[model samples]
Target: MPVDLETLYPKLVNLLLDPVFVVDESGNIVFVSDACESLLGYTASEMIGTLIFDYLHPDDRERTRAEANRVMTGHPHTNFENRYLHKDGHAVHILWSARWSEDDKLRIGLARNVTSLRRANQTRDALYRISEAAHGADSLRGICDGVRQVIAELFPRNDLHLAFYDPVRTVLTVPDWSVDRANDWVEGSMQPGTALAEVISLGQTLLASRDPSQPGLGVITESGLKSPGPLNWLGVPLISNDSVLGALVIESQSEHIRYCAADQELLQFVATQVAIVVERKRAEDHLRFLAHHDPLTGLTNRSLFYDRLETALKSAGRHNSLVALLYLDLNDFKQINDTLGHEAGDQLLIETARRLEQCTRETDTVARMGGDEFTVLLTDISDLAAVDAAVGKIREVMAVPMMQEGQIVLISFSVGVALYPQDGRTARHLLGSADSKMYEHKRRRQAG
Candidate 1:
């Protein structure tokens, strides 16, 4: 009634959860257990006589060879690890226990599929690194780059794209490193119907593959590289405090690589961390900007303008050049405010700031000193004539009619010009001279 030992041994090995392999000195797979079909998606008959090295992950081949040599030298390895490509083309992490059989002139090994365990460890490490990247990076772009790097490690042959939305300002911002961006893409508040836009607006994760039968994202190929097979694209919304702040999109760069539900979950976990850091950094940046900028007109404030004026004066002194300061006041600004209401008055001021910028060179400094008052520092001026010409350009631009509250209104401004060293050397002195000239011009307009 007892079974033969030879037949019973093979049956016991076949019933094992882990796959057993018998390889010759030439590294050919001479025999494999039935369980190998579950591990590598290959039947024993198909794998027999094939070179085991051909199935190894390219990056892990050299180290695996070294470990094989160690095992062949009678040093049996119980916990050796390597990666192999499954039949589906995704990498499968394997833990091996093997020994060289001298009598059989072959290497006998057992293979355990450790892919899930390895992925868990990798995900844990990746989350920690992403947290570091988010908080440690100096800017939003740096944070995005760091997140991309970490993701590339976890999911090989993939790229990450970041797009952030500010609900308060209604601006959509993508890092400069985004892949395959459209030619007309701009940073602003408007919503687009693109894939990434849908992810953000709908606050949902999207898993798309290239499907020839359907109209949506038929093929997920990036612009530069064409994958030989279908590429998977996964986008996860970055949610902060129940509001969608941005999206993190990952696309496969290789052939036949598809992202599954697990991949989406992992990316979402990391995205949560990214959203926290990005929001914190943006707030910090806004505060920093407000410290040196006029919130209403988005122009440089008095404090920063004073600093720049002093710096310009010193530079002019060094080069023996002239620097001019133009003080501007919106004539009858309060009268307009009283007549049209403060809302119309604010609109006029904002429009005035825009016109001032349009009339100046990029090198010139335009600032909002206070309500109805602005200053411009014109550096490296050749002579008084240059200053006069700049003032003329400003006056001409400001004279254009602006529609406020459905009413066409004509605006005017009075500018007082002061030259460094001529109007007095210091910032305070130059400012005083400009103020006096501005008041004198206002009085002259009144008398006329």
Candidate 2:
């Protein structure tokens, strides 16, 4: 092989990916690939006379020498991994294979661009951290974004998407997406939904592959959506508890080649994390629903009420507005409970909470302070008229008779209204004032 001409004898030193190195028997570097600039940031001239061993990453220098010596001895190694020091002082993990360059005085090293491989290895170890973070996510959007970010870090700037199946299998909605969920490849990204259901259910081809010939988002048929455009799609089945939860589809435009197997694997790992997060979020929502709610009444419990009340009061202070507190108790509740039993009473409380909730604007709050006692906080109360209006609405709904177990119970509520700053500032004081007014109103009703 002539050292001066590369094009004349292209077959003698031609490689598409791995950089080939030509060295003398004494291991002095001569010819290198055009990829040297990308891999090592050095031109061929800069590395021509440098000892091959001089450029190896200090950690991999010994192994690199051993591999070269072994290859020189006529034993060819197909694939091996070692680090090389780039001109910028970064360690490059190269997956190299070698053979003698015909003259026996020269050796050629071929390698895949495995700098991304090293990053992937490091990211795989770091997945546990993302997995742990996924545990605390509560909303679907947050969970999707978390999973996407973890994945995007591994395959930087790649399109990542996660879709979930609703209770019905028909709608494949984008529950929420993580970082850079969709890139420039698609016409528009609206967190694709049932729009891609046909492709998702029909696309049968899937596996661990390194094929870059097809784009990831190709499955979605553009004619099906409002706008027809080129899209490449790749999906991984999301299985949890032996059930198919949904499919996570990753995609990009035609400008980008389809995703590779390494990308698919990392996406699958992220999908698994997404499944965990989805389940966790469901459980948390269930727990939250149980805690801040009465099992029977479906009204805010005392805990949530107190927190809201405090916040409302703070808001009222800023607005220089009065907040009206109404403490209501049903007269003869015990009589109904004792004669009709607890289930009947529960129905009555449920109806009562519903009526009370409906009676006021959404900004106002009505909470079950455990049992027949209910508290309502009405912020920005304009005057006594506003208070009367709210109380009147409550009375109307309460008058809607409760038909429980074929028995009609006409329930009357005694509500005491107290104003903030006018009654007392503290929650305890306001509650006491409302309580006192309620009993006084009760007495008036009985006497009348």
Candidate 3:
């Protein structure tokens, strides 16, 4: 005997892997197939009485509703896509085919889960954004900002934190955060036992959510030690060439939202790209520093000195102010190098550089012009008395004895002064005048 059509139709719908749904004009789910349990993590009984729009991802709701209206107006929708919130709190990408039944005054739809395909596309877009940031950004901070923007799209929250590791100090410093509000973790160091610290220490990804059995993550703040307020945290180490540079962190304050393994994997991919960009930027910065600084004393080099002197001269000209240039050479520095050793001579130079730095104001530029010759540019000097005071302070600091190889070594400076627009207008001319006067002072001291 042949089976009846109504019984066979219901059996065929039950066999479909994709979920089929019938909804009233009010958007209430009147019928849902058993496949909904597998596709949305919701049983048919639980979804039957709920509004279809209630399960949609908040960001995709308006567009989905607009499409629903079209379908109810006798138009058939095919391949219409939107995101629905799964029962497990993750987004499920869905493609739908639906049409309205005028006689029954209901809408019938079939939903095909396309979450994996959508995620692949999202990953591609995210990687493209990171690549653009790496090559287009002018500074490390710009690259970080770009990465933060891409991450915000994926996590869609305001509590993201990015902590950078200082290899020399073995510490993690939070450099960027999404939210503007003050939190203990912003611009602060990550302490031991915190989620960020643990990720850095283990060089792995970690996910922490509200669990009474698990210990709370701790943080150090100005107020004191504190635990992170009820939130879900995910952290992934930024690793490059077997070294962990830092961590990328995502935080969710909503009790309903929790990070899963898939989120961790996506963030890890982003972190890898970030580490590469950061390493490249750091190398570029080191090269730039070496180009403008003295390797021995860590002071500004001759090139940098000339650049600053020229800048100061321009500023002085604009304001009709005075700029004093001081030329200094250690007295008998070569003799010290010959009597003692190069190592001892180096130690003396380093100490002298420190004393010179301490004698000048922060606005002054002090540079080592090869060997024991150094230059100081003091800008915005009010009068001759200010110049004399600065020179006198330098003399006093140079008189202090420096220890070299467990022995006391006395050092002094043969100094000369020149004023902008008075001794010379150009940097080259002023530098020459200072050098000539320095030699004159040295000869007078030797004669005396």
For model 1 the local lDDT of residue 42 reads 93
Candidate 2 lDDT, 357-397, residue by residue in tens: 77788898888987799999998888889888888888887
Local distance difference test, each candidate:
0.84, 0.70, 0.84
**Alpha-carbon RMSD of each model:** 5.0, 11.3, 4.7
Error of 3 at 108 (Å): 2.2
Off by over 4 Å in 1: 1-4, 34-38, 41-54, 61-75, 87-89, 165-173, 177-198, 210-231
lDDT of 3 by residue, 311-423 (tens): 99999999999999999999999999998899999989999999999999999999999999999999989999999999988988888888888888899889889999999
Model 1: weakest 10-residue lDDT segment is: 211-220
The TM-score of candidate 1 is 0.83
How far residue 195's Cα lies from its native spot in candidate 1, in Å, is: 4.2
Stretches of candidate 3 exceeding 4 Å from the true structure: 176-187, 210-231, 335-340, 398-403, 408-410
* Model 2: CA > 4 A from native: 1-109, 113-129, 132-140, 154-159, 164-231, 237-247, 259-263, 281-292, 314-319, 331-341, 401-403, 406-411, 446-448
What tens digits encode model 1's per-residue C-alpha lDDT throughout 1-448? 8879998999999999999999998899999999999987899999999999988877788998898888788999899998887776667889999999988989999999998898799789987898888778887778877987888888776766677787777777776653574432347563564556678778988765534342222243455875535446778899988999878877764445666665777888888888888788889999999999999999999999999999998898899999999999999999999999999999998999999999999999999999999999999899889999999999899999999888899988777888998997999999989988998999999999
> Candidate 2 at 167: error in angstroms?
2.4
Candidate 1: deviation at residue 85, Å?
3.3
On the 0 to 100 scale, the lDDT of residue 256 in model 3 is: 55
